[model samples]
Target: MSIKTTTLCALLGLLAPAAAIAQDSTASTLSRLLECKLTAAEVAAFTDRINAEDVQDFAHAGSDASGDAALSLWKSDAPVTAWGETSDLVHLSSTTEMLLAFKVTPGQELARGKAIVDRIGGMAPRPDQAAMEATYGWKGMDFRKPLSDNRNVRVLVDLSYSPGWVTVGCAYGDIQ
Candidate 1:
């Protein structure tokens, strides 16, 4: 299958299992994903926890590292409430760092990005239109909040918007 098709399936596959939970919602899953909160083990068990037979186009892009979780990514077609469907989704993990990156559908970048910043824990004063444009040169801004529970695991929410592309996601790990 094409990369786009595969990516879309992978993301749906990721969310489908969450939807089955008693009270889980797409926003909940999105929050966890944006925070880079899902552990390697949880991600690995996705295929088994959620029946592949039921989710269309779902594929567990399998990992190879035995003890350490190698870099892995999951894409989706699931749309967030108040936010449009993501164009792309990615997750990366290493011994010292983990990052989640996703491209938000146009027109919803600002609201979605702000909501994500709030969900992950806000930055001082919050970010606004002028701030994003001034700091990031039009349609760009980033806010970081070190996990209060774990100072070592810092996380940040970033939004980048350009003529034809917009990415809103987060990164966590040994970030400076």
Candidate 2:
């Protein structure tokens, strides 16, 4: 399709249900980018003017309990050992419930987040999730990659990282 056509389609996408559009843009953008890495400052710059509330919410997904717990983790003063900064990832999803793995601790927030998802969808982490660990060791996956996860759910740990690979996903959905 021509660039104009593609742009028009994306613009039209905005008219769809909020959830659908967010998921669509998120998936398409990530699929096209494949892998992305950036520093805290870089991410902030790329994300435009990130608000203070945005930092507070961090990885949010609707009104799920797990997302609440995950937000607590993000709010914690855990000095990012080797993260891109703030275990906070800025996503392109329209859904309020989106989280990027926090590398401050492996599976720290993911576990809690999954618990919330389970309560909602009753789904478990897929085996394919291990791809990140294999490609970027757990250490690299968390501390170095944009997302720090144990490869247990639909979360994409490949959104951003410092030195490793990760794939990040949206809450209640998939962005990879």
Candidate 3:
């Protein structure tokens, strides 16, 4: 083969994987979840995609309040591109809500979180970062979208930054 052709082929080969990794970013995953209705079947498919295992012992403050009021959780640490590294992913389902939480690198949280927020229609205005940080260790915003049955799905995004880690939680369910 000609030298020019061979070098071009090699460069293209290197770029292919980089392009794939960028498409498979955490932001994309979160965007997909934001679009989801969080139905039981949809949740099952998501867990299968991530290979998340059931958390048999998972419990929350109200888990014991009643027999059917228990919370269900699934978690996976499977390596996927996020902030140039892998981060923990958790899914929680309860009678009234579904939540997806994943960790992103501290410094990139706001920019990345906002990107996810921008994808959905009717999103709230970007919260003030300075006031948010001053008020607490996390920043949160909320918006609601109507579903086919006329019920509204309320979505909440919370970005929590601690000394060593940053976690972004997205929760959605019937507004009522």
Candidate with the greatest lDDT versus the true structure: 3
Score every model by TM-score. 0.35, 0.25, 0.37
Clashing pairs in 3: none
The local distance difference test score of each candidate is 0.42, 0.35, 0.43
Clashes of each: 2, 17, 0
Ordering by TM-score = 3, 1, 2
**Candidate 1: where are CA atoms >4 Å away?**
1-88, 91-103, 125-138, 149-170
Encode model 3's per-residue lDDT on 38-140: one tens digit a residue: 4545545554544453322222323232223222333332322222223333334443343444444656655654565555455554346457657775554
Expressed as tens digits, the lDDT of each residue in 38-100 for candidate 1 is 554443344333344433332234443111323354444443221232433334343223334
Error of 3 at 32 (Å): 8.9
Comparing 2 and 3 on TM-score, the stronger one: 3
- Candidate 1 matches the true fold with a TM-score of 0.35
